[model samples]
Target chain A: MTDRVIRLQEAPFDYGAECAAFAERAGGAGAVVTFLGLVRNDGGSLTRMEIDHYPGMTEAAIDAIAAEAATRFRLDSLLVLHRTGPMQPGEPIMMVATASRHRAEAFAAAEFLMDYLKSRAPFWKKEHRAEGPIWVAARDADEEALDRWAGGAG
Target chain B: MRVLYFAWVRERIGRPWEDVETTAATPAALADELAAREERYAAAFADRRALRVAVDQRLVDFDAPLEGAREVAFFPPMTGG
Candidate 1:
């Protein structure tokens, strides 16, 4: 398997299986870090999450982000998978995994990957509530988080 | 060129995408042209600062040239994880 993987699919992924597979694919790396995002059910009022993504741009943006992470952290391997379309609250939305020779490298790379993915990726989310569906607004915090990496990473 | 819309932009624009031929030279110019065509587009492009543009599937400034671009997309800031 390639060291870097990026996937966008509507099908839900098996978390346990993905982790085990990623670990194996990472091979001799001494450290592996992972992150997962799930739909948040707001006070039981949230019913679903609808993710819309640009077909060609989604893959391009993720690949570019992953490449940057790998270059900054010297990671041995990385995995990014995100789902689009409707998903129930509590279902997985996206995940990131990084493997590096050291713990710091793996951890930093994972965070960098996440911060960039949050606001830079061409994916928009809409939350379905009892009243109506509202587009999830981009938070200033996420943009700030991404800028924090401008000083550099790893 | 194929002009694409996503998320709320798509909803407000009333369609996912459309083929547009224009003398507009940049994303900003194209937006202005679209906004003039219909009330829905005007509503969508009303707050230009609230939207982002991509030329040929890559993010770029609103003033980026679209000379050779085959596609253009407009949407709000991303909320992905």
Candidate 2:
């Protein structure tokens, strides 16, 4: 089976390179779906953001998450990348690419992977504003997003 | 034992990470030990309502035994990508 997960640092990611990697690994796949989550300006209000992650634990968590997504959606391939350390506005924070024989599985898996990554990964974001450095609160919306995918075995 | 904090939990506690020797055996016991360290850890865990625990690298309940666990991590509900 093709490797179905990618997780790494907060460095610049090449969309083209990721696409090529997916194409090379995905044999006989008819569809590929990808999602990119950028560090938004958040309406130009925020100043800076810092992402923290456990060294070994972070990768393990992402890998487990990716593996689960692949199984649940029966995907042909999956790629997930998460950045750590300081990030400025408009930078890429993470990406998820999914490949499958059909559009349904690819799309669902990509979306599901993103949702699960947001709520389950070992990432912590701290925001800087004009006022001062303020750590962000975990949102209720995030939990609700993950809840949409509940009932599948852990 | 080593106690690690992530994200805002680190901020509230005023440190990103700390290592403390504990007589406690499990993650929950470690948490209690930390909570007793000072007001900072206590306040950091003031409302465990949104906090999450992980032993080694896998997520587990607070009460999950820490047998043979080398590392324990405490943090808020994840808000990753």
TM-score of chain A of each: 0.95, 0.90
Weakest lDDT window of 10 consecutive positions for candidate 1 chain A: A145-154
In every candidate, what fraction of the native interface contacts is reproduced?
0.94, 0.90
TM-score of each: 0.96, 0.90
Cα RMSD (angstroms) for every candidate in the order listed: 2.0, 2.1
Tens-digit lDDT track of model 1 for B1-81: 999999999999999999998989999999999999989999999999999999999899999999989999999999999
- Assess the local accuracy of residue A5 in candidate 2 as a C-alpha lDDT between 0 and 100: 65
Model 2 over residues B2-79: C-alpha lDDT tens digits?
Answer: 778887777778986777777776677787778887998898887777789888878899888887777788888777
lDDT of 1 by residue, A26-134 (tens): 8899898999898988789998889999998999999988888877888999999999999998899999999988999999999999998999899999999999989
Residue A5 local lDDT, model 1: 90
